[model samples]
Target chain A: MTATSPTARTGQVASAQPSARPGKRGDRTGAASRAPWLLLAPFLALFILTFVLPIFVAVGSSFTKVTRSGLFGEAGVKSEFAGFSNYAQALADGSFVASIGRMLLFGVVQVPVMIVLCTVLALMLESASAKWPGFFRAAYFLPYGVPGVIATILWSFLYVPGLSPLFDVAALVGLTPDFLGANTVLWSIANIVTWSYTGYNMLIIVAQLKAIPGELYEAAKVDGASTWRVALSIQLPLIRPALVLTTVFSIIGTLQLFAEAQVLKTVAPTIDSQYTPNLSAYTTAFAYNDYNVAAAQAVLIAVAAFVLSFAFLKFTNRKSS
Target chain B: MTATVTPTSTSASPARTSAAGTRRSGSKGRPSTIIVTAVLVVVALYFLIPVYWVVVAATKSTEDLFSTNGFWFAPTVALWDNLAQVLSYDNGIFIRWFLNSVLYAGIGALLATYFAAAGGYALAKYEFRGRNLVFGTILGGVLVPGTATALPLFLLFSQLGLANTYWSVLLPSLVSPFGLFLCRIYSQATVDTSLIEAARLDGAGELRIFHTIGLRVLTPALVTVFLFQLVGIWNNYFLPLVMLSDSGLYPITLGLNNWLSQVDRLPEFYELTTGGVLLSIIPLSIAMVVLQRFWRGGLTEGSVK
Candidate 1:
């Protein structure tokens, strides 16, 4: 199905080629060619200022080390090229590495659960027999409208024993689980992430499901396929792109888990300042004042994100092919 | 086959038409359907519970908040008093943060949407040199997680003496790579090249044609991009946390977090924080409910394409 779509698009482009020839010729002229660039100028300018320059700055700073001077190392500091020493130090830091590992474990566990839940919710909402699908869809997605910090605060209330109704119910049952404990905090963070994003991801999958040609379902129905059968064979297979997209997004989001952990740190004493890689980078820069090491860690995090996402895309593409 | 499989005609709900083909047909009143619906309802309740808790918790005074049931309202309501206290605390700083958030998200999204539309329109409708390169670079930007750049941005802004200022947050928020990508896909699907060619043949300048013709056709997409960016900027915490030091320039997220961190010292801030959080979410929730179609369209356009 994926293979045919590109060829079909190419066929359309081929048929449309004759008409586009004159336009292409006209576009070669100086003024005509300049128009596209002119329209793109504002976006590119901001993109460079915000995206490109910062990346270059971060990359450059990552290779340099900061040196302190004076009695308390407060009077003067110098920065000089250190030739990957900062990277070495960042990779050597056990706590930073542990944070990254924790994030990886978090993503591994949380992402699949979130994706499955999103898929199920999306499928249920799109099912014909579901009542008030619109209401459920909106209710499921409303959390995406709330900011992560606010969501964390709300969940923190539920985690705290004195404040949470969940605790009251748990206590009555003789089971008091400490959600914000050092061991359980990771899962608690995962819960918040899933709650915040499940709807957003579900929306994406539902969009893909909506895009499926009705004739395909019609044909499947004529074959006496059940709703569950059609969903597994047609909807799930066809929505692969959306699933992969959501997974890649979830992976990136997981690695950059900062806001929920940061906000919960106020209430959950077990949540250290360096709970996630992003948080560690943040603390390293602001608290330790080691901008170079922080930059190195940031660069490493970006590289890891790129590598993981690219690998996932490649693996999925290879499998599909 | 079409008559039998099309689900909209079978569903009793009026809203089902919008979601027509996505739904399964002939499944109403089935046992599996009932189970599915029940599970979905439970999931919906799980999602809404936290927001509901906050709403109920916000109405209680600090004394009543701890004493009363956690999920229900207090016997005597104090929502108005909590709002007053939240607004008046630290000389009405919550109101300032609210305005700052409005400024950041409102103007930032507007400008970002415009830039995305213009850029996306060019990429979609016009053929130019290095177009692929430009698009590729933007795609690369989309994958570079925004948090990874926050510290670097802070450093760069500090170098330029822009740190702790409104521009620090506003400048970064103005560039939305994901929005640009969405706009590109949307413009491709919606905008017509023949119209542009005709406009050019009639001696309409490129800028005028885009402003008058292209933007008019792209209003739906523009709204989609705008809302996406608005929510993103509104929900943003880390960018401002790293960039700004002044409370006056803080967005609602940072402001509320600051208030929350101080709750350990003065528990009175709990009611204020809850009130502040509830207030902060109202605008975005309204936007979500009203502009639901556009963002949904934006999401589908983004992921499907």
Candidate 2:
């Protein structure tokens, strides 16, 4: 991997020398001019087809409403331009707003806790005195390899009353807290998300930690700085980019919480079909066959995610720079 | 700043290396080290418990699953029985789902990686009009949560008569904005512009150059992108759930979820879901262990760039 870097530098120099000459005079440059477009064509085609077109369709559908024309609605439904009605309806939805608020609360509480845990774990692993870093790293990271659905399923087994060994243990202590209970189910889902992602975030932070030169540690040690002090002063400050990255990702993921909640809805009576924003949109579209409203909800969720993530990036960049 | 730090650090590094070594060996008796290790060990157990429970649960009979201790093995080992039952249940649908997941992830990642590599290489090595515009658009795609697209994609696909088909799931899975972004950065880091120029001078076509030299240099990054996309599509639930209503076409994630949702009514599906989950995870866990370097390298490279 390191070998590629120097070659890349030299390649920059080599390419720069030629591009300096007049572009119109060189036959080689003329042929290579169109190569970029040719190479980019396949990805561009797929990107527009999958990414751009869907958003266009979504936005278009979000502005329209389906109306029944014939008796018994058997003559087929016609789509008419509804202007902002779908968006209005979606915005007016109490459950939808509540779900979004729930997700926001989830992010506010969970993201910080997870980030701190990940940072602490990464620091522990990166410390010079730490032993068996490899074993612990893999052990922590193992959950990331497990699919979120499977991880949720595994945790749900622990959350359910009779099926849970944790419950049995709680029974032994005479304190069986209802994990999947309506009041506590959100935290249970939060636990699942944290378990699934904490290690992945830790790995990112640890990577950032590794890039910190060994000299920093030595310099700190020579200056009589302790391990904890070095970690606080050096490691934490340097890993700001990674911390920002993971926090933004967690925020976006928080709003898109569907699979765990959707799966848990069956086992937990407290979780409604519209327990999450994504789940609400999913059920509205598929279960109720209300595509326009679902499209509006999805667009709203996307906008919220975009704004939150962009704000985070802007905030972090301003501070870092 | 880094230049000044490097030389001073290097000159003092030899003594520091030995000092660090001694410190590491000598720190075993420290209370702080022991406490940190113990804390890590406890966290590791927290992560490992579910996996351990699943393995143990898969071995028990239905009677044992409910009656036996949730953490330990039952009187009789029924792992094979459970595996057989899971594989044979519902006309071998679990096996079908397993194969479907392999197909979706394997082929989807392959094509996605190729496109990302090609696109990234182009963006990095070639200067053109609208380059930054294209790059910016793709960067924007990275922020758009995928679940946000599922409902829209379903509407579009249904209109095109592609809904309830494999293409609906596979087509959308192929466009990974993150993979493309990673590849662009990786290509900039690894693929030499001069090498492409040289290959062009040898009368090789642009496509030929990319295939022969560019692909070779970008192999490690491509593998990283491939693995990321592979795991992503393998673990994906919402897209398939929204796109394909046909249970026959469900991936392992969706199919296992279906089985799990039925566990309350059927009650026999508990072992099957456990067995199916274990089966689904085996390949991913093996890949993670074996491809540890690429995974770490990809993530670090992505963040640093």
Candidate 3:
């Protein structure tokens, strides 16, 4: 990656010699090498200011603890260099640990369902001999266009028993389950997620499917293969990269699940305040004003997310490479 | 670009064989194909029904919303009334949130896309020191969850006296590492380097070459990145939840969330919240319709080339 350059690729494609071939390469070497760096400077500047610097601050803050006790009858706010105090407290807190476990459980159930639904839809769309795959693709992707907040609200209406026609139909069929009851709220959230994201992930898989050379399918047909076999053997394998990409995204999104769950709390009061790790962190920082502890909790959640993502990447990359 | 001119090998072979098979296959199973098409249409309708409900529901008054057939035609007209109430409520703050969302999504996506295009173009088109290192760092940024970043960003912004302001939301929205990665990949595909070098050789400065040649070549990818960022920023609520205190600065997302919370106390808010949901979706739908061709074209771009 480092050795390849636009100049070299251009030269190769054009079959042209560098203006001064091997001998005078030094004439162009110094200035030519600096151009990419100069172009990258502004991005790097913003990255440091907004991303890298804030991360360092978080790490540093995560190691400290706050206490208030003695003063000249004053509000004695103090920060101490208490190594791992915040982390220990965060890990030990029942709610924090419970939220992490809950989110992992949520992701475990939701991500697979989402991936399967998305893949099936993508396959169905790609396989259609119909005249309107374009229109159907857009229709499937429409929910992805709806903002999460808006989608959650829309789903809530459908979930409310009396208001939703779907629910009314269910009632007529002798299934009178509440959508946002204590027993079913998580699935309700998962439903909203699958609805919003199926199209988004389907687009990725469909794009990957479209990338597969038509020659492979023709060759498969010549070998007496069926539509299902073509899909199972060639199309699935070819789109594995995009599947892995969508899986990683789903994991991250499932972990950060907030909007739908938060909105559902309106209808379902039984949803505990800290039902997910992100919600817990938000409550800690904004509602509780425990910045240090919140920072520590955030770092832990982030590390967990990083570990899962990196493990996925490493496994996939090793196999692919 | 040259690849398009290179005789398409894959399609030529398939088209020859599939052409004959299609005619035979169509004669044998036309009915099943129709059934399949019907099934697909049903699935599509199932997916789109809620949106239709919202539109129709938005048009009905509170009484008619429940009294009318839930799935289809409304019994009354209340769209303008609901919209007027939504706008005039809380002193027209919903409009403010709409504007804030536009600013946050529009400006933030524009800047984010520019950074992504520039950084991605540079990475794609140049050989430089520590390039992999820089890219690896950006990839690392993509993996870290946004929820984790929110608390830390809040702390940092508080330290800088920037919390609870527009910048808190705006600044974070500009840092889309995935968009940068996609842009880099897309730029690598679309932009030919000889055109760039020829321009440079013709005495164009780096910025001028970038603006005149590189930017034009990068259009498709930039639009993709921009659309991604726009959807992202529009859906972004956790950041504002952590950053903003004043309801006056709320995006429609946060505003709707506030409305949602009060629905239990006031059932009237259910209608307003639903109406707000319907209203909120219009911008994104419009965006999709206008940009549909661009998005589809962009998605298929890298796959073939």
Candidate 4:
């Protein structure tokens, strides 16, 4: 678990409503005491059944081996303990290893660009002089409502040479962008992601910017700080929490990149079955019929996400404190 | 759109909109102002083009889809024709998918919202013995990615003969750790203890107190949790893709992808696929606009404490 797993990060703030209970009030009323347990039982039971048990099942199954009598594992099969072999095999697969590396590179470049872009857009739109902030925010945010599969389908049309007016416009200027080429396809997918998400991340930062007391800006203005100076000295430092939250979320999202790549597999030759860690695990389980090995790969994907997000929260928390 | 602006300071249209222009300091025509406006306008167009293209392409026949420009309307608008085809294709599977999405997102999110509210209000109000342990364990669920859980859940569900069933997807969609987390924070911050105490003192039963007082106070937070989980479940692809083999149970995402994967051999699916994508997003877009405030409030509560 993260040190400040988003929820626990914010315990104390200026509550708009006043409450008299500072310490835990010693109340052992008859019906009230049992109500909490009753209320919490269904959610807690479902949470464990879905979230907790699967994790244990995945880890437990990851260490097992399955042997089948028939080709394609269509006949009687038995599962036995596999030990660390699945982990070893997953790591040794060049494509699986490469997919993890690809995600790391993707996260490194994409997360910062998104955070900075979102922050800048939030600062600008929330600024006093900007016109139609609501309209622009909606315009930017409209894409997040479009599902990833839909977004990719829409973009692929633009990328295909004959279909898009964008291509026609680019051709007149003596430039032809091969968006589906092996080398450029990854970045083209990145463009789709960037377009879809920038507005959402910007909205989070805008919420944080709105939470800042109006008196802080008034005080800064009284001191004759230029807009640029105020943004740097005050706004940036104060919004670090939002930045950290967004960064962690982005890392998790990038590591789980599957739907876009899966949808693009037929059109883009560069993308294969094992183009991402999630996709690798998926293909291993369903197509190759290796649930035990697929479990290991899935476990590794989760571990990588945890490691990355934990490291980020650690780094940010240290600097902030 | 209009190039003529008198800068009288009264009328604030979007043409006055720029990245960094200060209508505040009476500096309307600053070079930075033009740069801001131009830059933002261009970014807006970037986001708008794909959406506009989908709308245009949805109006074309399958033949026109290939022959005409992707961004422009065809000579004749076949939008109604395409709509009819998309809805009626394969015995109206698209309608089934749309309804499936609504059912999954609607009922799943409502249950999730209620669960989060009830559980969160408990953790916020009660001083139980295992409160921290239960709450802390639930928070750990937040770190587990959805894909990780899907594989094992699919495996388990298959073992129990539940795979390819609606329960396989709906059961998982019912749990939202992030929503639960947000609910706790919002409840803690918003739900005052004295109000609950007074309600209890008014001879109200515990469940009644929760229904009348606790839930009433946590209404905004509940809405926030609902919207997030609604979108989360609606936008979900991996679960349904992994859980259900039956196209009858397919949500829009999986169904659309299924259509996309087949477009090369059966070229006529192009119109159906594009038209389906256009129709799927219509409700989501409306929900985004209507529930925009609640979402912002949700983010502010969790992100800015």
CA lDDT of each prediction against the hidden true structure: 0.85, 0.83, 0.78, 0.82
Report the poorest 10 consecutive residues by lDDT, candidate 4 chain B. B1-10
TM-score of each: 0.91, 0.91, 0.89, 0.90
**Per-residue lDDT of B167-193 in model 2, one digit per residue for the tens?**
999998888788878878878887888
Candidate 2 TM-score versus the reference: 0.91
- Model 1 segments beyond 4 Å from truth? A1-28, A71-77, B1-28, B301-305
User: What DockQ does candidate 2 have relative to the true complex?
Assistant: 0.36
TM-score computed on alpha carbons, candidate 1:
0.91
Question: Candidate 4 lDDT, tens digit per residue, A290-321?
Answer: 88899999999999999999998998878867
DockQ of each: 0.40, 0.36, 0.34, 0.41
| Cα-lDDT of candidate 4 | 0.82
State the local distance difference test value for candidate 2: 0.83
What is the per-residue lDDT of model 1 for residues B1-305, given as tens digits with 9 covering 90 to 100? 11111222222232322233334556566555666576666677788888899999999999988888887888899999999999998999999999999999999999999999899988988877689999999999999999999899999989999999999999998888888887788788878889988988887888899899989988877887898898899999999999988888999999999988998999999999999989988888877766777767766666544
Candidate whose DockQ is highest:
4
Q: After TM-score superposition, what is the CA distance of residue A163 in candidate 2 from its true location, in Å?
A: 1.4
